[model samples]
Target chain A: MSKHRLLAMFKGFDDSLPVLRDIKAGGCAGVSIDDVDYLSPIEHPDIDEILERKVNVQKFTFTGAVFGVTFGFFFLASAQASFLVQPQGGKAVVPFPTNFVLMYEMLIFFGIWTTVFSFLFLAGLLRKRGTLYSEKLTVDQCGIMLEVDEHKLKSVKEYFKKQKSIEIREEAVT
Target chain B: MEIKDKIIDENLGWQRINEDVIRSMDAPGKYYWITFAVCIAMVLCAVAAEIYQYRMGMGTVGLNNPHMWDMYIATFVFWIGMSHAGTLLSAILHIIHAQWRKPIYRFAEAMTTFSLMTAGFFPMIHLGRVWNLYWVLPYVSDRGIWPNFRSPLVWDAFAISTYLSASALFLVIGMIPDMAILRDHAKGWRRKAYGILALGWRGDDRQWRVFRKTYMLMACFLIPLAVSVHSIVSSDFAMSIMPGWHVTTFPPYFVAGALYSGCAAIMTLFIILRYFFRMEEYMTLNIMEKTCKLTFAIAMVWSYLNIIEFASTWYGHNTYDKELLINKANGPYAHIFWLMLFCGSVAPFALAFQKLRRHMPTMFAVSLILQLGMFVERWMIVAPTLSMAHNPHQWDVLYGSIIEWAIVFGSFGWFSLLFLVFVKLFPSVSMYEVKELTFHLKHEMEEEKEAAATSSKSKAGAVGKPGLEGA
Candidate 1:
């Protein structure tokens, strides 16, 4: 069956929170709250509760940092070993202290690139399908969009209206 | 509900902030175009001079055996130092949750990215054969030779490239949400441009969560990276066998000087941006005052380091170092050295007075003079030491030729042009961060009022009690 999507806009973050809470509560009453998304000009504190359910990018960051440290040391050590055994003056062939500088820099370099990679990967950036968005959401308004059953659409719209949503947009989703 | 409504409503509304900042991206006044044209002319002149120098060889710009590293290297260091204030200031302030940084950090970070780009050109220019510059990279070649891992120069290549990539990413990541704001408001070509740059930023909670985490992680990474980048640059001189250059204190000394000059540059740009963009409301007098205070503190730190460097040289009694120090004070460069003292050491004291700090014209002039001092300071570090090195027979005064002067002028113009284009393309002031600041301020005020009401209510209840002795 084709589903309906409802997008409700509110003037303030505080006003939007109650609507989001009610939408979550509505799911317990047999209404399919298939997905809920909150949009705002600035990140709102209440959004943290919803974010707990999303994929964590920090794990990727950890993995990247580990790889960076390991690769940094390995690259320097191997470079030293690859050169001819002609010791410059009385110094050691592999100067560990001096090599640490490049290794340190590489650690930061790899760590940053991996963090960026993970963000792009998990955030689903450069995706083919665009998200449901409203221009006003980037300005003074806050938005809540939900995919719900058609029978529950009227109740959802009424609930949002009662909660003082400034604008409500509805569209059919196949 | 009333409390929520009152707390949510702020003086600088989201719509107003958007309109004020995004207006600069619209058709700027005729003056902007004129300034832009002048910058382009300067840049072209610089490019012409570079081509001339390239054809005539390194001899066109005044380099000799003893004094091999001259104005190009000095200017390179100056620009690298100038780049430090932006990322260091933004990252450090953001980490500490300094709300005042919201309006200025965007431009400051842009400065970091552009100055690094400008600084990157110098080593190539100094290389004479700029074409073979990629030899510094550590790639395995058919010759089976690898870049020496022990060389500080190699360390510099790694540090600078890493910093450039990291800061550039940091800059872009911070701008995504703001770009999304512009994408929504813009039309035609602007819409397409911002839409692509915005990376489909939809302001979803999930995306923001990851963004904030990533941004914080980068900031944490950047603080150390910024410090290390300058330290490695300083190592270029410190690790050398030259007497005056081989000082243990050079790293910290260079870092302090870099921050000092960088802060001054930021003040210079801050005032100019305020005047041009009508951003007086955002870049208010109070913010300028705080910035001046920070600059003054850094100036004092740099001056302290300078004294320590001089004192240590005089006390250590190393013949080459002492000779260089004496020559710096009483040699042909004496006038420039004294001028550096006055500009770097004395002028920043003017900021100590509130009247002078708040006076835009006075502060602007002081910033320019301070930067002059810094430029000369870099020159002094290079020329005097090389001129009065261990072998007295080779000592001779080296000066920059006309080509060097043109390139210096062009570098300033190039930096300005990049900044101008950036301001036009992106919202120079961060839109969302500023809104966040406004919200926090409003919330704080509401909380204070509620606390006061609660205290008064309890006091009234106690006063009405019959058991009160005063009653």
Candidate 2:
């Protein structure tokens, strides 16, 4: 089994800020932002620095594009070179301009595909449900999800209460 | 009113935007059923036409000699061009942070993907043996003969497939948050479907941060990809050394025309979605005005390029090019050439008038006219070039047989079919983005109200005691 998770809901983004802040200052039992998950009706980019830091996914896009270019160059060049039995007119066996076009397309193709895959992986999507969910969190409410040890569940519930969270769901993941 | 005030009506809250868009996804009513039936009937007609054409071969479509590329290729080009507007709105405007594109961008992006799907059909329809389509793909075969990468047609294969993959990913990625909303509110099978599609999106900070970055990166790749896609499409004509088809200016000209036609399509769909979905608050007159202004600008650019091509051909004293241009004006296709000019160049002047542009009915009519003009322009490009391609012995005035006509008209039905199904299955508007727009607009409104209150208080205070009352 996994750890116990606390799901706290507030009316709006602003209402959820202080609890996120207060909990950060007070700290949990070896819990940090990595163990914390947020749910909301909409995007809230503003969060206490201690609670969450923006994740980077651009490196995957760059690596994907580089790989695409290298693969495209090798694949297209070798195909052209293999067919040197009958050269078409005076044209070079492997022309740069023609191969470059496909290479450019490949870069964008791989760049977007890699970016999307990395985003899905890093964001913890397409997996078994790990956090307790509430429909209202998607509708009009803001949610803060924090994971902690089993013994510390009561004190975290108190933290949610201190901030006047409208609804809270406590669940143990296995 | 300033467009800032009009982006989202003050009366709308986040919940209203969510519920209203979700309500739009409810089993569509009688009119939707009627339109859907009509689209199906048209597609059936097209399917029957394709079957007949397949059995009887290319002769049925009047594809002979130099006239091998006719209505199918032209319509393919037209649909491919049509896909550009979505990229303009969804990717370019997104990168630039054009907030006005928010409400209308979802449908426009959907248009990009659907039009590309529709456009992709033409090459297959044009092919004599459709089953050999895999010959275009690079794979290990015992024969060892690869597709000619030297050909622009092969470049097209690469560009279109990459374009299709990138735009489809962009559309689905952008829809994840909205899908999550639907998953929560949805019931039964729909809930499960959306649950899988949403990929367990909780709008967590990590998900959002990564989503924002991923979306922006795709947008960057998409803009150049869009330009390259159309430019490569133009190369199918421009790379050919046949008189009028050989113009150096063809790439930019085609790009301009693509944007022009796409913006018009967006206008037509914007009105339909607004009226059908009852999305007045979200779609808004101001966005329509901005769209009209953009379309008009692109139309003018297209017109200018048309003139430049004519002038360069005339001034360069290339007898072949000049004669084709003249024959286009005076030959059997003269009526179409002039109508293309009138619809593509002249009719767009109506958009310059603010009164006509903002009124939905007039804009709808104008958008349809522009589409007609763009369609005919494609016809003009293919027919005139073939008829006047340098060799007098080979010249022939080709008229499309009924099979060709059915396939051409059927494409519109095919597109409408995909779109109708998509609108019901998906939220045509972005829910979370609208919430963000409403959030910003609310703050801007509050600031404006506070400023107004302060100004009024100062005026009232001055009126009771000071001499400069009304000032």
Q: Give the number of the best model, judged by lDDT.
A: 2
Model 1, residue pairs in steric clash: none
Question: How much is the lDDT of residue A68 in candidate 2?
Answer: 92
* Candidate 1 residue lDDT tens string, B1-471: 243233123577789999999987778789999999999999998899899989999887777778799898999999999989899999999999877888898998999999999999899988989998888998766677778777889999999999999999999999999999999999998999999998888887767778888888888889999999999999999999787788889998888888888999989988998998989878878778888999999999999999999999999998888888999999989999999999999999999999998899999999999999999999999988888888888988876888988988899899999999999999889999989988887878889889999999998989889788565
lDDT of 1 by residue, A1-174 (tens): 568877889998889887667666663344444477777888776666743465567777777777887888787778777775654677676788977787788878988888888887776666654345688988878888778788878887887788898999988876
Residue B106, model 2, lDDT = 94
Badly placed stretches (over 4 Å) of model 2 are A1-3, A25-34, A48-52, B1-5, B449-471
- Candidate 2 chain B, which ten residues in sequence have the lowest lDDT sum? B1-10
* Candidate 1's TM-score on the B chain: 0.96
Q: lDDT, candidate 1, residue B98?
A: 78
Task: Show the colliding residue pairs in model 2.
Answer: none
Alpha-carbon shift of residue B247 in model 2 (angstroms):
1.4
**TM-score of each model, paired residue for residue:** 0.95, 0.94
Location of the lowest summed lDDT over 10 successive residues in candidate 1 chain B: B1-10
The share of true interface contacts that also appear in candidate 1 amounts to 0.67
Poorly placed runs, candidate 1 (over 4 Å):
A23-28, A31-34, A85-87, A129-131, B1-10, B469-471
DockQ of each: 0.70, 0.72
